[model samples]
Target chain A: MASPVFRGKAITYGDDVNTDVIIPARYCTSFRAEELALHCMEDLDPEFLKKRRPGDLIVAGNNFGCGSSRENAPLAIMGAGIACVIAKSFARIFYRNSINIGLPILESPEAAQAIAEGHEIEVDLGAGRIRNLTTGASFTAHPFPEGIRAIMAAGGMVGFVRARLGVDAPAQPGRERKRSQG
Target chain B: MGMTIAEKILAAHAGVPVVRPGELYFAGLDLVMGTDVTTALSAEVFAQMGAQRVFDPDKVALVNDHFVPAKDIAAATLAQTMRRFAERYGIRHYYELGSSGICHTLVPDEGLVSPGDLVVGADSHTCTYGAVGAFATGIGSTDMAAAWALGESWFRVPETFRVIFRGRLPEWVGGKDLILRVVGDLGEDGARYKALEFVGDTIETLPMAGRFTVCNMAIEAGAKTGIIAADDATREYLKGRATRHGVYHRPDPDARYARTLEYDVSGLEPMVACPYSPANVKPISQVEALPIDQVVLGSCTNGRVEDFRIAATILKSRGVHPKLRLIAIPGSQAVFRQLLYEGIVAVLAEAGATISPPTCGPCIGGHMGVLGPGERGLFTTNRNFKGRNGHPTSEVYLSGPAVAAATAATGKITDPRTLMG
Candidate 1:
């Protein structure tokens, strides 16, 4: 509620971290949230799911999310409670998807190399700061676009849309939009 | 005052009169798409928004190719979710593991797209459809869901750049190399969001497969789509296909483009897109000597049967290098059967190439031949971005299937031209 707090350790990687490896082509069938979360990073480090803790930050090189543009890759990581991602750069599609889902993806070349895996860290969006609790290092990431930040502040695109229309949340298995005519 | 083919299409879809370049036109989208990941989340968003119906189910398509053949329990669940959403929405076109190929190829091949239409897919390479002369581009999944509900989307009318390939291509120089050279000339992102129209006699001579290869990498240059006017070749390719959809035409002779660059195809040698960027291209001669740990020959870009036949001929009686792991993935089940029937599969198998099911496999860094740390790979896929095939330190070299096959045999980069000789 308070700027969506994120507290976790960090995992590091270089540029062009594609979605296929993050979620894998094999696990594409699973739709359950819990199920998808379990397969995060099965390729880079088979033990990643076992070893990762909630609120962990994934640090990587440029062009993160370079191929396919699958949303599952980001969902799996975020659903696993990854606090945020800090990369040198990100693919155009993945970057926008992360923001729409209310996941924080920070870009900073220095921040990519500043933290080590398992090092407790906190990301404060309001202040645009990343606090490495273990190393006592603080890094700054560019502020999100105002419109994007507004969506994230509301929790995600769905929440933002609902808030924009001043409508009550609906509960249903699979319903269509009343505004579909637009 | 000049307009590009992309500009012409966007103008028609813009709902406004006379769209000019550099003007932001929030044009309505004719089609919006989501694959495995976005489909599930978008359904939830729909539920939260109390939406009872999509704007138009006919315009929506869903496919599960990202995590095909479900490597793990979680991925299988994601695929199921996408399948459920496609079914519940009555999405007319749905592709699963057995039916799925890369989304870019699947869309056009299934006849879901046509020229002059504006389409947006939730994947970057969605630009592939631009080969058909559609003003198609990739957008975020969230953007796609918005379009699903509203049937509208925004765009900035882009300027156009003309790429003209002239002269005859050497036998071994294929579409893959042509695009690589294009990427080399135009730095990655050089044409970001621009429309690219390819011209010249060389383009006329190249087959549809080669045209697709060039269009497939339009995204690498950050172009909205790469297009060539549909000619006799286009008519021939579309002749037997269902005529229910697709638009084809040649650009107006007076059509305006922002800039034009020309190249000679015969002068082109095999090229590779080095790690971290598709634009980082080098001739095969420069990198052909580097030892490789893997060679992959498939993807939407170069996974067609013609690519395989070309590779098979190069691989006949040749064995994979002892140190190289060569993986061959047919683009689709159709191609797989063709290879099987033609005995091409047998020859490839005898050459020590590991064959995988017809899925995107390893092209997007998925399962089936991910390179280990510091490992170098020569692949026929479109991209060679850093960490694209597993280890960030691993090097990926993008090439034509002929080049991949040739390199697999020597364990080092070798020119496909020599193999042809």
Candidate 2:
């Protein structure tokens, strides 16, 4: 099972970190997960690679991912192995995208201020807990709704659907289901 | 206890208890559409999830747009991903690049959508479909993957804001202007978590293209979706569409709105969205006459037959200023072919304009018409955000196609009203 708690350092940004800046338009056509990871945060800090740790958390102001509804932006972050993000608020698309990929995202300006770059921290989803390992300061997060948490715990929506419907993984090849009625 | 258009649509589709604004509800999404850029990723996510079959392949629309001619190998790969996925899933509504227009424009034209249905697309501009009375908005690829696998998603029903555009609009004033004015009045986040319903006589008189323009920019104002009640134009637009598609309308005589706000259309003027933000709007008259190096006159916004006709009228017999690199890109093949048949293309060329293939170029700073360093251009595209048209230093001012043509002819920020009379 994936860890319910995340431990990491911190990276901060201001409001409205649009999709264009997160992954830029030039990299939009590329489908390889590796190439996108290289471009993540390149717009804001070209040398982010040298500064980042594997489990570092990103802290941002309101409306992060406020521009295009591109999934690559969040996918790049998750691919790069960043553990979580705490922001004042999030663009609706980004919030949904982060959850869909099983990336933990918390909304708390207080915790955002408490953590600093290179500072160690821990986050627990089920318990709605966040702890700064460096300073020993702990905070709380709003746990996901029961249904959404179940889906997240299953690793994503697809896993949840497979489990609930009792369908085999990858449903049988050459088996196309008819359109379901609304 | 007011209900939003999103809530109403969900309630109607769910066929259960009433829903209020801000309340979260999970419902089966009626449709999910995507262009080349989106479908490719969605297919990948589906594969990662190990889902062999989509919840409803028939309801999934795959349109190969964004990079229409397959500009490079990467774009071609994305398009190919969509093709293979459509073939594997037995998707019926796959639109090839040449056959399709913009994804948002093509959805309604193909008759796959209807009123009161919840549509989630991977493109931000997908909200444009709300003009037809559907509760359409954008989502990301991952959320779209959920919709693909389960045929459903959750939404926080938004509050409703009734915007009444009354009286007659001035000649140069149009849909682009109306939407800009609405943004000005409401501020960028004023309508956050709210649905906008355009009502009153002025909106009733506007054409379908005009209504689409208004709905397209609803996202800029932070609204869930901008909508208008279905009327004669809606009926005519849907008349020739296939009968299998669902048709829905607003509640009769006693319809209710949460918060009603009115605007005097007659007082509004042509508007421009300054570089760096869509919310920074100013009257076109206030924009100084600065020389431009480029002029782009097409996009999902202001890229229709009527838009081209008005532009052609302005460009008739007048050559584009030698200093300006004028470009016109039709929104769709139909618009492109029709402009050629109607000789609008000849007029545009005679006026010294370069025509490009029908695709969104330079609107989001994608390939075709990137600006060089220190370049300044007047564009007919929506949103003139900083670096939107290539160089972060390049300045782009948003305007209607008519103003774009006029500016191209004069080589500066000139208004269409000056040339007309």
Candidate 3:
């Protein structure tokens, strides 16, 4: 799988956007990714689901995904057809959870400050480059380690581990296996 | 080179002579816990990963606490999934709705964790086990699935933040106040990816329940885990409940620290974390008389017997305000039983507080006592993030049991001292 080069319109938010606002605990009863996506960011912005376009990028402030260790927060973002998230900083658990689920999130302290809502941005995961098309400004984020990049390339930890154990085929970027139990 | 307790525990589990911060290793876990809300998903992931069996059944515990007694069809189905997974895997420590309490409390009460052990759980409050000197932290369901599959999980050794408490705590000021002060000073993400080592005279004298309360909120400050060196109090608390006894480790006096904070608790006042964030803390004196619609007095953080005892004392002759709704939930069945045996339950019931089973009711907004739009709640549960209780517009203030009881009596956020006086 090749590293991703994403270009999308950015939906921005401020600091400390917690999980409760991302996906409230009430909707967490469902384990299905698609089901969770329906309520993603519903409380914080009731129009988030309706307004979000496929491959849209979320640009947010520091400590994004701060409360609760719910993996559904990232899953919902991925299921909402979001391509990636760029934040000033992320909570520790959410950072790991996002990577484990193959949602590429970059941290650029300058990206949120410079980018405006509905700005079109380009991201190159391999090069760690984020460019704001609307402003013609670019910023660099810390690149993921080769191992993690490989896992993300594999669509997530499950696919990564399956490929490592020879139980599944090598992953193709952006292609995820259906998460149904046989 | 000297190491902190967290590093030492990680080293032992990783089968390495020594380890340092920033080093990643897969360490064997002594215990891995999950709740009904988490385990069902983890079980699905575990099956999806094609793991034939759990790495070690004895070291794993699955509890039904988050949606205990099954609040709805979805929650009941989730619980059923976990139950079947436990039965199929022959998991030795599965606790059903009536039998189990909160995972964080039940694991230790049942002797499932001990000092110097590496522990992980799906619930973020799993760090509560660190009160026993165990290296415990929370993980996501995917990581939990990996741990269940391999009996080991990867970790990045965290920098240690040394917090020393001096002087004696003032009356009515307990772990909740101390931890709130820490979060207030450090901010929510101040200790991100770091381990907290709580020490000094005040911590040494604190009861195990109080220690648990402090450790339970470590995650609120973004700490990977919070630890206190096991002492006589810890030993006594774990006396018959510990599955194993072993040498407990403490930080070397000269161990390097990322930062050291000293807190004098003699003058500390009861505190509250206001709406929107746990780090937005202020002394109860500052927010006194803020009208409240509800009061929640139980959770893993302050849901122990001692907390209820404090609440009962405050509510003894005083009745809850007619406009208020008070909900008291015990952390575990064990704590619930003590409430009954001591008649604390009766006291709360007579005072107009409704007693619920030992589930994480309304704390995570799952069920029971959920708030509506424009409502405000004062609770003992950790995390007051926006929309945390139930409705997005609803607000929550976090405080200790004493303040909760006082607030219930007056239907407002009142300082416990006002009632005590």
DockQ of each: 0.24, 0.43, 0.52
DockQ score of the complex predicted as candidate 2: 0.43
Per-residue lDDT of model 1, residues B202-305, tens digit only: 88888888888888888787676788776677666656553445556556677777778889777888888877667889987787689889999988888888
TM-score of chain B of 2: 0.95
TM-score of chain A by itself in each prediction: 0.83, 0.83, 0.85
Best by TM-score: 3
- Estimate, for each residue in B256-300, the C-alpha lDDT of model 3 and write its tens digit: 899999998999999999988899999988999899999999999
How large is the interface RMSD of candidate 1? 3.9
Question: lDDT of model 3 at residue A161?
Answer: 58
Docking class of 2: acceptable
Model 2 clash pairs are B276-B386
DockQ of candidate 3 against the true complex? 0.52
Segments of candidate 3 deviating more than 4 angstroms: A146-150, A163-182
Shift of residue B115 alpha carbon in model 3, Å: 0.6
In lDDT terms, which candidate is top? 3
